[model samples]
Target chain A: MFGEYSLSELASIFAMQGFSGLILFSVFVLMALGLAIIYGQMGVINMAHGEFMILGAYVTYLVSRAFGELPHALFNVYFPVAMVAAFLVAGALGAFVEWALIRRLYRRPLDTLLATWGLSLILQQLYRTIFGAREVGVTMPEWMMGSLKLSDTIEVPINGILVMGIAVAISIAVGVMMHRSSWGRQVRAVVQNRTMAGAVGIDTERTDRLTFAVGCGIAGVAGSAFTMIGSTGPSSGQLYIVDTFLVVVFGGAASLLGTIASAFTISQAQSILEFFLSGSMAKVLTLLTVVGILMLRPQGLFALKLRK
Target chain B: MLKIANLRSGYGASEVLHGLDLELAPGEIVAVMGRNGMGKSTLMKTLMGIIPAMGGEMSVAQTPLNGLKSHKRVAAGVAYVPQGRMIFSALTVQENIETGLTVTGRREAPQDLYSMFPVLWEMRGRRGGNLSGGQQQQLAIARALASDPKTLLLDEPTEGIQPSIIKDMARTLKQLRDARGLSILVSEQVLSFALDVADRIVVIDNGRFVHEAQRADVDAAAVERFLSV
Candidate 1:
């Protein structure tokens, strides 16, 4: 591999690969943040989380198609409107799921895993029946198109920069919400001790429902962003589910900073390695490394020191 | 004020509190004394709606609370400090107290809560997990008081606490009762602590209130007989 390329060529390749890795990092962070909230804070193994993401993608697809027929000026602002719609639709469904299914399985983590896995399949089939089996793509606004030239040999995509900005904004928003908001205090309380949270007048059940909804809403926004890089299909969300879960677990549950850090590490490793090796091999090696590290530490990169 | 009539509750199929009746007047502290596994904590849990009341009626300040959920019961002016403190260990002391304010829709805790447990104020930025057991207990109490509840239910507040701190806790409970007109229902294994703070004592055995009397009129020997293994 070293002999195949000259020094200048290698530098440009590495630079381009690094920038691509950042784009991948943005998607991983967006997906993992939602999973972290559900699995880490609420302790609910939501296997249907990917399906929730797909729902958002489908919503975005619908919004974009609807805007295509309207005035040309409407197309520019449709992305934000689609994002909000995706969040609301996905969040409403999440709240319903919590009320109907997740609430009954609070004490049974494994049961929730199985039930949500079944729910994921059901949702996939529902999408297939409604949206068809074909993958759909959204038209990018004019501002989101084109690339910026960095050097004589290296250039960066505007869409990639946009996604990175979204990821950073969302991560900071989540951190502030978790630390500074009153609702976040109630969520932390319930996560630590449900019975005591209830005793102290915190509506533990409501807190749980809202947390789950917000987590799903974030996943919706992630899916909306995904349209810029990948096409939406009934099973597109499934492709990213395992990697996102790995990001969250390898980061350390309940640690927002850890999630972003882990996403960056994993995405960059995979992106760079894929340039030299096959995609599957790169993924396997990255995952194996994470597993090896997790086995030694078991608490991931940053564990919250909470009393049993 | 709090009132319970023939309250029955338990874990799973096994009943722990069998038609137990109790009452508390405004500003009065009632101590439920019993040995382990004798339904002392169960009574407190049931009162707070932690465990469903299998059968019976409960009211706080004339508001019926029989069918209310735990949070709704808390909103009905009842607050509980469960056994082992059960503070949100990962949260900072200030955030832990803010849970109370959040539930009650209040912007901040009362200034008196900080004066009552000054240690909490000193370590406000520290995580609850980092606190000593006594400090955690104080945090638990302060968290409960932040809700400004009409009634407080405390389970084994003095357990594992230092003697000096226990005295201070007793004094704080007395002061809260006298100053705020808050009714308190506390369950304890320590006889002296209960006697030190309670206006009335109820002795429980085998999930029933077998003996009840005013603190001044109670026979110490008879109460000890119910508590002794």
Candidate 2:
């Protein structure tokens, strides 16, 4: 079934495979972006990041179900609704976590990590209780379920392409928000020097809460988009959390560009390896590579300057 | 104008500022000179509402500042340029300056931070972490100026800075006070700098105000004795 015919056929196969790689990169990049903001900037390990993403996925699932009875034409309009719902659900949860738990743990980063991990477990169980333990496949709209054939030898699924495009757009939007805007500058200021930022009247407290919320909201968007291609369940986020963290840590914290670059490298490597090796072994290989590189460069691919 | 009466503050268990009474007139360069850990910076922080004051009356204009949050005090037209020139290291010079814009609310930054410190203008794209100490000091002071604050609180502005930059900063403070009628409350460890610029001097020793004098009344021997031990 895997065998191909000729040179043109092989080229098409590579193109199709490259498209799949891009899709993988997009998924991981979005997942890592939130983790990057939380862990990189605030130094909060936020092990609950995956759960936040799962909350978004669950929100997407609920929206899709609610809209299922609507006319076919109306289903298309509900996409925006689903996105907004996912963002609000995840962001609200994030704000709550910051207020109830994170605010108290600012002085103890490690404790925050442990506490967030516990929160992640609690959230997962909460999800399982509400959504049931079964793995649920997201039903794509008719337009999303089809594939486009570039040639006789190659076909690329439309849903994967859509995911790839959305991921790139989100990354660009996030970068602009972090680099170009006044609020973005304030966020960076808080990250760089919290006390100094306060001294200058930057409202560091507000910045902290908003930054965490934005991070979780983006994670929700990632999770919602993931429903297009993957299984959704309480534990669905756990499957990606390790990979997400690997991408962020291997990329470097607070470095969005680093996240994108590392996502490309890691996803492509894993995709190529899975083609030759077993799927589980491919992941192990990628993880090992990340570990080795991190050992050599303790600061990862980018080093945020801490002092002059 | 800035005013304080019966200001009392301290860290947990130990009091650092005891019933501190002081005031800064609009457009006046007043200095609080002391040795290390003499509650100079603490007084500055208390005025800015960073560290909670145990008890006191503090005000910027008619707005009471003792109960206000640090950021609110900033918005009330009080600016603080802290010691060690704490500019955001990872931010580019322009981005660091932009932080001042956030605190200023709807008000736009005046013409050019670049004009105030031409070197910062020349290296606007460079990371603040890469700038020299003198440049960072300039950036810190320039950042405060960006808000067009009515009162500027500078804590040890000359610490770890080059002599040329020190003179430039002193000159800039005078010029700003003269031009904008900016109220200045500067904390300093060096007597010479304070003597050169201050209209009045207040001395704090071991967390208590020990002496108050106008420039001519400031006895050098008394200052040295208060600062020594």
DockQ leader: 1
Show pairs that collide, candidate 2: none
Give the per-residue lDDT digits (tens) of candidate 2, residues A113-197. 8999999999999998998999776667788888998777778899898888878888998899988877788888888788888
Predicted candidate 2 versus true structure: per-residue lDDT over B112-213, tens digit per residue = 567878898888899998999989988888888777688999999898887877887788888888888999999998888888888899888888888989
Docking category for candidate 1?
medium
Off by over 4 Å in 2: A1-17, A304-307
* Model 1: per-residue Cα lDDT over A1-308, one tens digit each: 76899999899989999999999999899889999999999999999989999899899999999999999999988988998999999999999999999999999999999999999999999999999999999998899999999999899999899888888888899989988888888888888788778888878889999999999999998998888888999998899999999999999987888998999999999999999999999999999999999999788898877655
Which residue pairs show collisions in model 1? none
> lDDT for each of the candidates?
0.91, 0.85
Name the regions of candidate 1 deviating beyond 4 angstroms.
A306-308
Report the C-alpha displacement of residue A14, candidate 2, in angstroms: 5.0
Please tell me what DockQ candidate 1 reaches: 0.73
**Which candidate has the top score in TM-score?**
1
| TM-score values for chain B across all models | 0.98, 0.95
